[model samples]
Target: MDEKRSVRISKTLSRVLRHDPASIGITLDEAGWVPVQTLLTALGRKGTRITRDELDHVVAVNNKKRFAYSEDGSAIRASQGHSVAVDLGLAAAVPPAVLYHGTTGAHLDAIFREGLRPMSRQDVHLSADTETAVRVGSRHGRPVVLTVDAAALHAAGHEFRISANGVWLTDAVPPGHLGRLAR
Candidate 1:
């Protein structure tokens, strides 16, 4: 499939699998998985016809590694970035000394004051590298990267998880633990 079509399908999959499965008349299980066949049927019904091979290709080649299949290949789910409540089943892990968060210039003031909250999602998504954070920030607008004192936060009793896609996950980052990296 072409990049445009693959991206469109990937976005739709993100919506249904992460944010609103109900929009497609389906539901994710507690761990955020749904039967692969069920997902295909629902997508077809919603006027987005996708074959199994296309779905496989999308999961295989998405740049961000946004989706995953079950161990037995029966189900699939978004690796992270869920708006709705769903346990990703990720274990708490030790993060590096630092991490990064990316956001637009518009949110910097509030972020500096309030720190980084998950907002609508379950956890504040973080990146291990500045470049990845910059790309994430670019999606919103003019990018700004923030350095997070992950080691300090962890020492202070905060928890961290590494998602399947390598995005760091945490409940929030207090202002004390954050510093501006680039604007």
Candidate 2:
């Protein structure tokens, strides 16, 4: 498929898998997986006809590795970034000494005071590299990268998990653990 079409399908998949499976007449289990055949049928009913091969291609070539198939190939789910209340089944892992969060400059004041909360999502998403964080921040506005003291947070009993796609996940990053990175 062409890039535009693939992206459209990917976005639809993300919406169904991460936020609202009910919109497509499906449900994600506690671990956030839905049977592959059920997903395809629902997509068909919803007027988005994606063949198995095309789905496989999307899963394989998505830039962010956003979707993952179950080990037996019978199910699929988003790797992370869920807005609905489904567990991702990720184990807690030690983060690096530092991690990065990207956002627009406009949010800095609130962040400085309130810390980085998940807002609407389940966890605060973080990046392992500044460049990726910058890219993510660019989506909101003028990008600002913030450094996170991951080791310190972990030492203080904050849990962290690296998603299958490598995005860092944590409940929140209090302001005490954050510092503005110099541009």
Candidate 3:
């Protein structure tokens, strides 16, 4: 699959698997998994026919590693970035001393005042490294990377969980735990 087709499929998968399974008439289970065939059928019904080969290809080469197949290879789900309510089943783990968030300057004043809120998503998504944070932030506009005091937050009893794709997930980053990093 070309990058364009792969990306299109990925966005579709991200939508149904993460944010809107009901939009395609499929129901994700408690853990946000749906049988792979069911998803293909649902997409087909919606006139976005993606083949199994294309699906597998997109899942394999997605740059962000956004989707995952179940251990038994019968089902699939988004690794993170869900706006809908579905527990990812990630456990609290000690994060490194620092984490990073990427955002546009338009949100900086609010972010500096309110810290990082999840916004539309379930948990605030953070990158384990600055490069990834820059890429994430650039998606919105000119990127600004914010340094997170992960260790201090963890010590203070804030929970941290690493996603399957290495994104750090947390309920919120209070202003005290945030620091300006770079534009």
Candidate 4:
């Protein structure tokens, strides 16, 4: 495939894996993988197609490096989540802290923009428990759990953020977060 077309495929695959395609203007869901029909439709919109062999070629060309292959080789997934997945994942981690969220969806965008990205996802994930999962949840007047000490973030430092649903955006919170927070 041409470099331009290859780049498009990579972007399309990333959108499929991370944000819901429908949310970004595309519509596709093939049971954890984009269905061939949906792929065809998208390709058609872009004026392209694969004659089975071409599909195999694309899969063979990018497998494991830029994407993953299903057991039967009938499906594929982005290697991580996007073209810049590694960079995002490898950035400094967030610290244990109180994460806030909007009880209503209206404040979701603000929470993410102001709370999530800037903070490490490993320090918080997002949750619906206030006074508990602090790392994940939000602060938009919603109940959320504030993880007292996320091991990952604790090891990393005190830089963190919150998820849309109020969950801490951490890699993983320790099991005894409740006790840790109490202290």
Give the lDDT of residue 56 in candidate 2. 94
Could you tell me every candidate's TM-score relative to the true structure? 0.98, 0.98, 0.98, 0.36
Per-residue lDDT of candidate 1, residues 1-183 (tens digit):
899999999999988998999998998999999999999999999899999999999999999999999999999999999999999889999999999998888998899899999999999999999999999999989898999999999999999999999999999999999998944
Q: What would the per-residue lDDT of candidate 4 be over residues 78-135, giving only the tens digit for each residue? A: 4333322222323343533433222334634444344433232223344334534342
lDDT of 1 at 99: 99
Candidate 2 — which pairs collide? Answer: none
Query: What number of clashing residue pairs does each candidate have, in the order they appear?
Result: 0, 0, 0, 43
Off by over 4 Å in 2: none
Worst 10 residues of 2 by lDDT: 81-90
Model 4 has a clash total of 43
List per-candidate RMSD values in Å. Answer: 0.9, 0.8, 0.8, 13.0
- Top-lDDT structure, candidate number: 2
| Per-model lDDT | 0.95, 0.95, 0.92, 0.43
lDDT score at residue 141, model 4, on the 0-100 scale: 45
